[model samples]
Target: MAAPLTLLLIVAVTIRAALYRSSLVDIISERVEVVSPLTAWKRVVEGLALLDLGVSPYAGDVFHETPLIIYLFHFVIDYAEITFMLADVITAVALYMSAQEYNKQVFRKQRFALEADRYPMDCIELIRSPKEMYYIPLKVAMFYLLNPFTILSCVAKATCGLNNAVISLFILATIKGNVLLSAIFLSLATYQSIYPLTLCASALLYLMQRQYIPVNPRRASFWWFVAQYAFMYLGSLFVIVGLSFFLLGSWDFLPSVYGFMEHPVFLIFMQLAVISIFKSYPTVGDIALYMAFLPLWNHLHRFLRNIFLVSCVLLSCSALFPVLWHLWIYAGSANSNFYYAITLLFNVAQILLVSDYFYAFLRREHHLTYGLYLKRKDGSEATLVLK
Candidate 1:
């Protein structure tokens, strides 16, 4: 049922303008401008020359910071159509895999595990009747149908390199008890994009819960917790060091992470993380999505993943509108703000839209409650009167 929508998302991203040749050089130029300010002017001048080349010398310029794998797009991804479509296909696969995991947790494990004897995790769970086991599928089916945020965030990473869908899949694999594979995926994810290093969050969480592996003979949660955070902090420190070596220019700004903490958006991003955890808590999939979005934070330690993954790009775009407009008005870049505002608006729309899907899951639960109450035979119960 979800397969077709997954395909549609891939198709849409492949056609977006950002994937085309015309914009590739410019995107690289922006990065170069940020990292190598000295070369910014020279690169811009040379960048302009690409416009009229005979064989188009500039068409195949190596992206100094990007891997050859991503650079493969230069030679092959000719049309905007091909780019979006390919992105969609990649995203569709990643998203479905994520959804499969979610299904296992929410439907197979948690839903099945509960019984009248087991105290409920929340109030609704305690109060509700047996509901007949068959309804679990109906509920899960409804969630997959409505979970926009889950779909978009999964999709966005695949399309835009907004985050590493590949690495995310790897992290999910680890949480699913594939530790050796997780290690390999983790290394590859780091190599692919520096930001996925924050996947430490999920790694730590998994290790704490006894799901992560070291093949330890002793099963002490304390030692496991220590080892997990020890690795998390250690991995984080080294990943930063590695990025500093590779990105070289970012070395200059590393101090800022420890310095001023004045930005309001910083708090907002943190709040979003906190809120998301409270709302759905972290499944390995949810954690991956959160880690992916972390890089989009307005900070240096940001993850390589972002909400613009092939899935979320469109939905995020819708939310970006007011956010960027306010930024444009403040930055006073009235002349150049139009495009920037448009880009941001789209990103925001996509995120909120995706989130709406999760909230819809909760709504489905609410609807169930509402339905059961409506079917109550007692006349007073229908009037919202005390039982």
Candidate 2:
């Protein structure tokens, strides 16, 4: 594990170091498709400057990052590049360790279930063998370290890498059954970005599963467990938010950071619907989706088909983005509509990629439980219909 991880680190560092030395770093950092309002390194620097001058970093709307992040860079501004690189490395290592631990737990549960005859005889084939799970951690680490998005983010010095690292650490702590560490890391992630609050659902589910607690809402034990985790998550979030308030002496961040929560649940849903319906910048959505959870879907790739087509579509989209942007922004030969058309195509390709894998995963699960081939009542072959 150390040798392979060291090799991966060497490769990743070489790529980043070369990019840093090249003239492309500046160009990549300014691209809208690569940097956003929240994760842009430029804004972080701006905030740090204001902090150094004893001014509130949030005085201007230019800095949208959380207070914690600004303070983090205040002391380490000179080592920004190294900080971003270390964040990426930390994220990869945490994810690798978490994956290794998770596989062991899953295999142990499977063995116990088999000995207890908990699974149907026909479901035996669905059971994963130790050999297949052996290198999953290494593969996960490699996928994350070598992923193009991660590389681009690192080279550009986008602060998204830090957010990802925090979330990855949260996952690692959670999988290791350290409730306090998990809650703290999770709160740190939520402080950086509100999107990670959704991860609470998965954390709760994993904890419950680890305890062998059935998810029955009517049970007191189930409710007690939910309350316990919820309290820890919310308590930590509250403390962090209060600290931010004390640091800034202003509540301006409340609206910008968590305004989505001001409304009732139905209103929140409506707000999201409105944003989706009226959004003019699909690139933001595309990048957010791709960067966040794409690696987690690696296991579904083997079950999917049309890999060649999906690969081509994705690669073509990646290449075309800059070209289309150039034509629209500088060339002015192409209009917004032209750029948008490619954006739409890119998003559609992403949808197809995810949907195909989803379909394949469901189909594979069905085949594993029931026989791989199905027959109709009249002895004719049957086909599976998603509808």
Candidate 3:
């Protein structure tokens, strides 16, 4: 795994380095789908210039990144390309570790269930084998590192890579049962973009589950654990916010950075796609994070209804985005409506993809619990319908 991961990193780095030096770097950086205003390298450069001139980066409406980001680039501006590449590497590695840890937990639970004879005899076919689970983490890393969206985001130097790294670290920490580190990374992620704040509840729920704490409202232990995690998360967030203010000596960033994104409902896996579509300024980097998780749910493929159709739609949209943008902005043959129509279709496709996966996952769980062939009380075949 180490050798393969290292080779993948090398290949990923080589590709990014090549693109960074090519004529397409500028074009890639300017693409609206690849680099949004909030995460754009160009705006980061502008912010760095403002900071160098003793002016606030947020004084103008151009830069909306957090203060820590501006200062981070201030020191490493010369190696911006390397920094973005490193961020992508960190994200992939973290996700790999996370997937590995999660697989272990799942296998452990399945073993326990088997020992207890909790699953139906007819559902034996649904049991996962070690061989099938072994390559999931590696595939997860490969998916992320080799994903065209991830590659483009890295080449464009989008800070969305940094955000993904933070979120990935948060996930790794959560799965590894390090409460404090999870809270810290979660805070950092939320601080980077308000959208990640929704992950707090999911992380808390996962941590509680790992600790064998039931979610009964009457349990003092449950409440205590919740309070403890909340305090750590909020405290870490406060410290990060305070440090930002101390660095800049003002609260100007509050409105400029945190105020830019909308808050959505908490559906951990689906939230990433929602953010990518609904954020004030979205980019391909945001979509890469969610798409990387698809492999983790590969077992649900047999139950998925629209996987092929959704895949076709997503691929078509990805290719047409540039063509439509070129027509609208450069060729002047198409209008904003033309490009926006594609954007709407792209988002709808993503929503359908996420929804289909969610349904498939639920169906798999149902089958695993009740047996593959469900029957009614009268011995007639039964069907499950989602409202």
The count of residue-pair clashes in candidate 3 stands at: 0
What local lDDT does model 1 show for residue 212? Answer: 26
* Candidate 2 lDDT over residue span 343-383, tens digit each: 56655665566557556656655654455567789867799
Q: Model 2 residue 372 lDDT?
A: 55
* Model 1: per-residue Cα lDDT at residue 202: 48
> Cα miss at 349, model 1 (Å)?
12
Per-residue lDDT of candidate 3, residues 208-310 (tens digit): 6611112221101222233345647555444534443343232222223332111111145665665565554567888899888888877778899998998
Flag the better candidate by lDDT, 1 or 2.
Answer: 2
- Per-model clash counts, in order, read 41, 0, 0
Instruction: Name the Cα RMSD for model 3.
Output: 12.8
Candidate 1: global Cα-lDDT? 0.37
Cα lDDT of all candidates, in order?
Answer: 0.37, 0.63, 0.75
- In model 3, the clashing pairs are none
Residue 149 displacement (Å), model 3? 0.5
Residue 77 of model 1: what lDDT? 41
Return the lDDT, model 3, position 375. 88
lDDT of 2 at 69: 84
Ranking by lDDT: 3, 2, 1
Per-residue error at 159 for model 3, in Å?
0.6
Error of 1 at 207 (Å): 6.1
